[model samples]
Target: MSSQFLVTSRRDMEERGWDQLDFVYINGDAYVDHPSFAAAVIGRVLESRGYRVGIISQPDWHSAEPFKALGRPRLAALITAGNLDSMLNEKTAAKKFRSRDNYSPGGETGRRPERATIVYANRMREAYKDVPIIIGGIEASLRRFAHYDYWSNKVRHSILLDSKADILSYGMGERSVAEIADALAEGKTTAEMYDIRGICYVTSRAPLSDKAVMCPSYEEVRDDKKAFAEAFKIQYEEQDPYHGRTIIQPSENRFVVQTPPALPLTTEEMDAIYELPFQRRWHPMYDEAGGVPALQEVQFSLTSQRGCFGHCHFCAITSHQGRIIQHRSHESLLREAKRMTELPDFKGYIHDVGGPTANFRHEACGKQRISGACRNRHCIGSEVCPNLDTSHEDYRRLLREIRQVPGVKKVFVRSGLRYDYVLADHNKKFVEELCQYHVSGQLKVAPEHVVKHVTDLMGKADAQAFLKFKEWFDEANRKLGKKQYLVPYFMSSHPGCTLRDAVELAEFLRDMHMQPEQVQDFIPTPGSLSTAMYYTGMNPLTGEKVYVARRPEEKQMQRALMQYKNPANYDIVYKALCQAGRRDLIGFGPKCLIPPRRLKGTRPEQTPQRRGSLQLPKKTRRRDTRGRK
Candidate 1:
């Protein structure tokens, strides 16, 4: 079992009695030999195929010597910015530096250098000038094309180009990485593996592929927001593995060509990947600094599936994992549960038993595998597709089996659940089981917005679906004799959201009596449909104008409306209500969101005069989606 972990140092290599490694994996995360970490998965995959892989976890960026800790590999150096993009790890939407990094050991901050992938690649190049560098993971995957970087506030070139790497494996890289390793082992140069699907590489000359879709050049996207949006739309439509086209993005000196996404692993292949002998814990080297905080969430949690078809515009899962739901078999999950029971830290509780969406245990529909997901229509948004298979019998049965495991006491599903899909199910047994066994009091659901127009732009199901699910949840708890609650999540200042829209959302929240502890201020991360809307002020899908709240004050007002009950947000909420002509909501009425009185210890005369344009509120009563007045 000790030898199962890949070599990380000269001592480990000597222990393994190996002369040299085939690949040296450089990651900006602490070494946690678990599948949840990309370094572990890719390393284990390469090892399973008879390749010797070494790991360099969060090497010091100030010097090149840290990159050469394991010496040079026999073949290539594979790098990932851990499980998250490094810039996002270091900074927030307001561009403020964060104080802690969960992926780092001891939850410390600033362990990895900024722009981690590029930084790591450059450092490795400094160490070994001629070694091939292959970069991937969330950072490289999302930035494979010219992208709008929130931190830099400008379009940046592909990571492959910026990092000067030999190749960039965009999506799930198991198949492509294996093929690259094999090709390299067979005396092929990294540049010759450009034809491999799921990888992007830079070339000095234009690509000669006949089936390529040429995107707006980097200069064009940099100069024109509309051109950027158009290029994003093209990339978005071609993400399907079955029907995706080869995409080529041009630059002045070279071309960045991305092959179509790799085909999804079959159920058997997914089972094999999970069945790999992952120690399922952080490497012992991290034990002294209180271990890796990131593994705590996933240690007891079993990932029964991969990928999501929910297709939320703001989510990057659709772009990275694809819309197809590739799930593990019941036997594989049960074995994993048994394995968890044997672990010394097992607390008789399975923290979670789900993936991106909890209830999705199979493909969205019958034709998804054959025809690929519908690019034009969402499977479960706006309206549930007629072809949508909303049954949860398999998932329900799997949970039942896990509950019966000898050492397991309770199992919870803490991952995001698509409630609209629950509403579409006619069987209704899964909801009962979920409430009876899975939910830990409050079930978290993402109903991003209540306004139909806002939801339409966000590509989410209508609020009525959420309303129906809430009713079902309430009734289920009542029948089961349980005291459970629903914790609905909301997003503020999304594309197309206005001051009026925020006010409407506030009214809906007031009716529901939900004062969320946290509110997500929309951050435009690259490779998402919503980011395209944020950048262009137009729907990439429709090319129609959308009102985007760009001003910091306007964005603050919208976020304030979500938690209007908080005393800190009173001024912003008051001004927003007044500006949106909803002054009727300002008085001391029970329905009012804020009080008309001034703050404590302040004179009434101190209250500022109301602006003349503040229109009198209308008397019409609008029923919420829950049918509440």
Candidate 2:
């Protein structure tokens, strides 16, 4: 297994009979030689082009001593904060420390430092004073522009400025990373590598291109919230690859310049990248420590595409992967499927077969490839555009082909399906087949919320779209004679979401008889329109005033409403109902969120306790919520 993996120690390099390495990848997670991990993908991509690469995972930040273990790379030091932003990985949306880090071995926590990109880059500089350090992955990509840092409670400059790395590869970095490595290897300095797309660097001179856009500087955005919102608007609209311009902003004494994103990979390129020889599992060193938790679901999965067109405000996919989808050919995917069948550990089940959005197997429309995604409009927001390609025929064909492969027991589409996108398509075969074969017990979708304002602010489809899909799903399952369900993911305390809006969503859940086990509290990560709105209190795209739930208590109340049936949320649910002046919902009626407080002098037993706290429960407790009795 160690022979199959990239060089991690001096012994591995010696075993490979190499005295020098082209690039040494520093990652925040334990070294896992899988394409699902960014560190592995970049390393393999470099290897394919005849470059030697090594791995240095989760080095100690106490000093420069640990970074030198892998020795200095001849080309440069490639660094990433693993697959997720270091802060988001370490803390929950409530700013509380997370109990576990799935990306770490044995589901460990505290393995990586806060702001890992900056910390790792600084240490690399200490280890090799003149090494050309490059930072990428979610942390550097989303923070390419000055963004509102929710954890710090202030606006911070672009990560390129803070990390002090020679170059920052912003988006999916297959192209930019290779170009950077080639330039470095060709005796070119980092200062001469500004023309690469999807890369950002700091400079002192003004932008030379007439097409470049001058956004508000760090001082302006930091001092004025309105300035911050305006700057975000420019950043959001300019994500286009075909027509996008270079973005320049002043930071302190220097400036940060970002070129337009790299174009979506061609089918051949996508196929070649995914078909790389990957171990597809955590390093064997962790075999005794229960391996990496993150690989459990993905080891048997296949990534059939890249990019997303949903463009939800809270999501940064469009910012990082762009809005135009790029997919591998069916033949390429089938090849990967065939390989999985031969693995001894494969359970004959392909856990998933999708990307950012499961059903988006192609670009949004023909125009996107030519002129790029519309400047200020979303592909599917309140209404679907007439030019939008709402066909899932290709995706359906791909799934069917996989299912027909040898030794593949079942092919499940575990990733989320844009329900609105499903409804927009006239053909119902995909959804019907999905319900019949792909789904195990449920099909999960994300409507975000039911309130029109919240959905509008979030740039998501309305509740009508979700309900229609739910109806279609239930009918399809009933006709198929299967007892399946639809799990709709809803978030709370998003920008523009108020107490009344939460109440409306709770009532909608009650009407649907849905007791959602999880409710996502909106996290204002960098590089999202929602975070801009959260920081500025105004929608950057629309210029409308937005109500942000900045208080922790308010956000908790909003989250509790969606799970009002849970005994632990009774107090918060009551507080929210009262705050919204919706006392009508606090009664013995079946539609009520919770039973009215037990009579003032009621007996202790009559007051109810633990999970069965509601005295006048309309639904029987049974053995538990699942009726396991």
Candidate 3:
């Protein structure tokens, strides 16, 4: 383990000649000093600015005593719910408790309490009422507004108010966090730090500026679906950092003010952030409990970029990281690769060099920085934006440089790719090189759904785009004499998807002779356009009604349709087909999805087999023998 790991104990602080620290970072995950972990990134960012920061990871939330492990900080304490929302980390799409947690030590669950930000905040307040609490990370960032909560089946107020934290920092919070720390150091109160962008706070009075947009209040939206939909539309459109307005929402006795998003860091600034001295490993104290499971994949991988322009409706990346794409320079990435090689357990492989969309290293257009992402339109829609830059030359160059790094034998680009953008690119060389060098036999692309209505609701290109990309991918691999395949990820039970739509997707898969092993069931997580639609049954943008699958059985049936080959899902698939009026598809013909029922006298074991086609014996024919009959 690297000795450069962050201090987790008071003894380590004393060894460094420090009796007290400036900021103590309370994290929901077990300590892992890797950049991919938000806890480590924020800690390192503060350390780079000459602040003494100690980390306390996954402390006991039962009492205030555990939160006081690091004692009182000279300044304030920063908190995060690790890399994912606590509810998301602990529960599955089906709302069942997950037995293993990737962010916890030894893949153990129950290490952190549910609604961890709220839980930790309460404990911290109990321990020291005067210490200002600044909460960020995925949980607090997405829930910063009054949004839908699928777990509880209702609308909830801003996490900032719910947790009663002094300030809530949203998005990739490097710049805003610095402003916060500086203000606290200057003896400024949280109330005085109102001008900082990318943060939300409670104020007794209204925002002084008339430019602020007052969305539906907590009371109005919680009770009225129309008000909720309108508020969500306003929130979705104003995500741009430049053109966005200061949004205020009234709560019971006060108001919550959210400033415009923070501007993205420049290339040089992005480089400096990633090049910070990080141990890139879980703390050795976790060595006994085996290491934090989340670090294993990212310890060797590099996050060359942050933020996504795709803005998929189901994803929280846009709300948490903001829209504009930010990336590191080639030189900085190469430096990180060299350091990875120096580790004792280092293999010759570099697992991934991608972010939300691996191939989208450049912004959609040059005007993004000058103005902002378009107000109500998607950068990608029915047609690729004419102004969109589809060139992959920069990405190609970056990959070439990393492959030449000494001791790095193989490099993989395992992150999700926007096939729509790739298909739009005129250059075939990037595609060819990717098939030959970067891929280890399979490349993952997300088409989400096949039906136009469903894909439109998902903010994805239509299925034809994926088909064309697959054609090009096959051609590229053929030219290189390689046998690479594409794994297309699909989802079920999103806002606009109904039983009919799921059956359409299942039939599409059947025609393609593909039965996917895993299917993604959409969970209406906070701060997403799809979640608003799920809760209100209306498209926030257009005010048109949308079909929502809120029942547990319906959602399960939709998921089962995608993996219809599984015998355990047979009953659900049959019920789904019958419900969708697709019983015509339930035969042993060439296009049949399943075999006919047991014929009233067949053996008990006569069930559909999980084979290439999942088809059982075809009914024998008295067929076409009309003349003989």
Off-target runs (Cα >4 Å) in candidate 3 are 598-629
What lDDT does the true structure give each of the candidates? 0.84, 0.84, 0.84
Return the number of clashes found in candidate 3: 0
How many pairs of residues collide in each model? 0, 0, 0
**Residue pairs whose backbone atoms clash in candidate 3:** none
Question: How do the residues 431-528 of candidate 3 rate in per-residue lDDT, one tens digit apiece?
Answer: 88998899987776778789999988888999998788877888898898876777667788999999999999989988887777666788788888
**Candidate 2 Cα misplacement greater than 4 A, ranges:** 1-3, 598-629
Please list the Cα RMSD from the true structure of every candidate, rounded to 1 decimal place.
6.5, 5.3, 7.5
Winner of 1 and 2 under lDDT:
2
lDDT of 2 by residue, 339-370 (tens): 98988899899999998788888888999888
Candidates, ranked, lDDT: 2, 3, 1
**Candidate 1: tens digits of C-alpha lDDT, residues 1-629:** 33367788899899889888899999999999887888898998999899999999999999999998888889999999988778877887667897777789899997998899999999999999999999999889999999998788889998888899999998778989999999999999987898899999888777766678999999999999899988998999999998888898898778998898899899899899888989988888888899998788788998898788777888788888888999999899999899889989989999888887888889999988998988788887777789899988888899999999999999998777888887788656778889899987767677889999999888798788888887788778888998777766677889989999999999987777666545677778878888889888899788999898988899889988977777777898889998999999988898999888545754322122222111111121111101100
Judge candidate 2 against the unseen true structure and give its global Cα lDDT, from 0 to 1. Answer: 0.84
